[model samples]
Target chain A: MYERTIDDTVTTFGVSGKLWRDSMIMYDRATESLWSHITGECFRGAHEGAKLAVVPSTQTTWAEWRTHHPGSRILFKPGGKGEGSHYRRYFDDPARFGIHGRGIDDDRLAGKDLVLGVRFGDDRVAYPIAAFGDASVRNDSIAGVPVVLIYMKESEAVHVYERTADEKTVHFEPVIAENGLLMRDRETGSLWNPARGEGIEGPRAGNRLERIPATKIFWFAWQTFYPRSRIGGID
Target chain B: MTGTAVLFTLLLQASAPFERSQEVLMGDTLYSVLPLDAIPAIDEPQFVPVAVADTFLAPTEMIIGVSIDGDDRAYSAWQLDEHEIVNDVVGGVPIAVTW
Candidate 1:
C-alpha cells in the first residue's frame, strides 16, 4: 500500500511471516529492521524508529491502470501457475475471519467494511466506501486542510488530494467523461484526472494537486492502528 | 594434507561458528514474532518487461502503481503474493515492491 524506500537506500524487504496487531511485519535486508507494513516504520533492529518515505500510490484494477498508463510495465510471476488468490476465501467471508487477541474491538463500522484512511499530522480520517455510492468526488477537509477524496467504482480505487492550488481554494465536482470519471474545478472549470491528480485543461492546466498518502483497508484494521482516527461519515 | 594441519583446521572451524549477535533493542522480544528467516525474504528479485496488453493479469487484479520522476511502474499483487518482495529501480530511484 506504500512505497518501500528507507533512508537514502532503496532497501529490499520481505514478509517476515509475522503479524503484530493482525498487520503484516516486513523486514528490510540492508539493516534487518522489522517494519509494520501498515505504518512503514521500523519497529526493531539497528534502524529502529526509522520511517520509510511515503510515496503516493494508487491501488486500482489492471484495466483502469492500463487505460491511463498503457505503456507501463506490469509484474508477472516468473513461473506462476495461476493459482488464483491466496486470500480468496479471506475476502469472500471477511467477517467470519477470526482475529486473535482481545481489547481491540471498535464497532464504529462493520469489521469488514472497506475504508480509505488518510493521516495528516496527528489528524486521521477514514472515508468509508459506502459513503461515496455513485459520487466520484467528495470535497472535504481534514484537520482544517481542504482535501478531495476521489473514488472510482470501475476499479474500486480511491485517491485523496489537497484542494488548494496556487494559494486559492478549489472545489471539485464529478463529471462523467468519455474516458471515465473526471473532476471539474468549480473555480476555473479546469478538468482534473483524479487518478493522476493533475489538471488537464482550462485555466488550471499544468497545475497538479498534491496527493495525500492513504490506505485502502478494512475498518477494523484501520481502527486498530488508528483508534483516534475520525470516521468521515459518522462525525 | 598432513594430519596436524587437518586438526588445526578443524579446531579453527569449531572455534568460529557462524553466529550473529541476537541483541535487539526493540521492545518486542527477538524472534518472538517469528524466527529469523521464517518466510525467507527475497534478496534480489527478477523482473521481466512485457507489453501492457500481454501482462496476462486479470482486469480486476490489484496493483501498486508508483510514478516517480515521470517514470511509472506497476507491481502486480498476484505476483507479489508469491514472492512477497521485489527490489526494483525506476526513473533512477530504487524501490522495494512488497505485497
Candidate 2:
C-alpha cells in the first residue's frame, strides 16, 4: 500500500503489466510514470525518481479481521463470481510455476517460504512464518533499533513495532488470554494487541506501539530485491 | 534554468538508470516477464462503502486492510486478482492498493 501522490499532485495508479525483479510495476495516470510495486518508487517516465509513501497494512482472513474489527468495512465485487484465489495453485506448489527462473542462488530458505520482511535504512530482517508456527512474539533489534515482531496463527498476520514507550524499553512475552494471543510487556504487564499495536491493559494502557512498516512476501521475491537481508531465527 | 527545468533536472538525477530499449527494460529474467500492458493495469476501479456484515465474501477470503488517520477500509484480494489495482481514498488520504 502506498500514498498515490507525486509533487503535490494526487494521482491514481494502475498496473503497467510490467515486471521488474519479479514484482509488479505501477503507472500513474497523471504522469504515466512507472513505479515498482514493491518499493513504491517510480523508475520510468516524467515522474521518475518519485516515490509513494508506504502505509502499514495487514493481510489476514476475513473472519479474523471481522472479529477484531466488528464495524470495519470489507472490499468486494458486486455480482462477481468467487473464483477463489488466482494464485492458489502457485502458492500450493510454487516450484511448479517457476516464476523465478533458474532458481535463486541462495539456499538459506526455500524459494516459496513466506516471510515477514522489515527494513531500517539499508539493514533488513526477515521472519520466516514456518519458524513462528502459531502465536509468537520476538523482541529483537534491527540496526540498533529495538523492535518486536508478533505473529498470530488465527489471522496469519505479522506486525512489527518499536518496543519503547515513555523512554522505557519494554519487553514482551506471548500470553494466551480470553481475547486470544496478546503481547504482554514485562515491565508494566500491559497486554498489547500486536495487530492493532495498542496497549489494552496495565500501567501502559492507551499507549500505542510505534509500527514499523513491513511486508509479508515470498522469500524468492524478497531475496531478489534484498539479497543481504538477515533471516530471523537464524544464528 | 527555470524552476520547472531545475526540478526536472533534479528528478532525472535521482531517477534509476534507464535502458535505451523498452524491450531490455521489460526483459527481466528473474521472473517470467510479461510484455508491457500484457496483464493490463486497471486504471479506474470503483469502490463503495458498505458495512462489514453486508459483505458477501467467504470468511477465509483474504483482504488488504488499510487504515489512514481514523478511517479504515479493506480491499478484497479476489477483486484485486481481477483488477490488479485500486485507487481509493481513506480519511482524506489518497492511496493505491496494488495486488
DockQ each candidate and list the results.
Answer: 0.19, 0.24
lDDT of 1 by residue, A55-133 (tens): 5567677778878886676665555545444432333344542222123367888766778888776688888888888
TM-score of chain B of each: 0.53, 0.54
- Candidate 2's residue-wise lDDT over B53-94, tens digit each? 344556776677877777767766645655666777777888
What is the DockQ of the complex in model 1?
Answer: 0.19
Clashing pairs in 1: none
Q: Positional deviation of B35 in candidate 1, in angstroms?
A: 3.3
TM-score of each candidate?
0.51, 0.53
Cα deviation of A172, candidate 1, in Å:
19
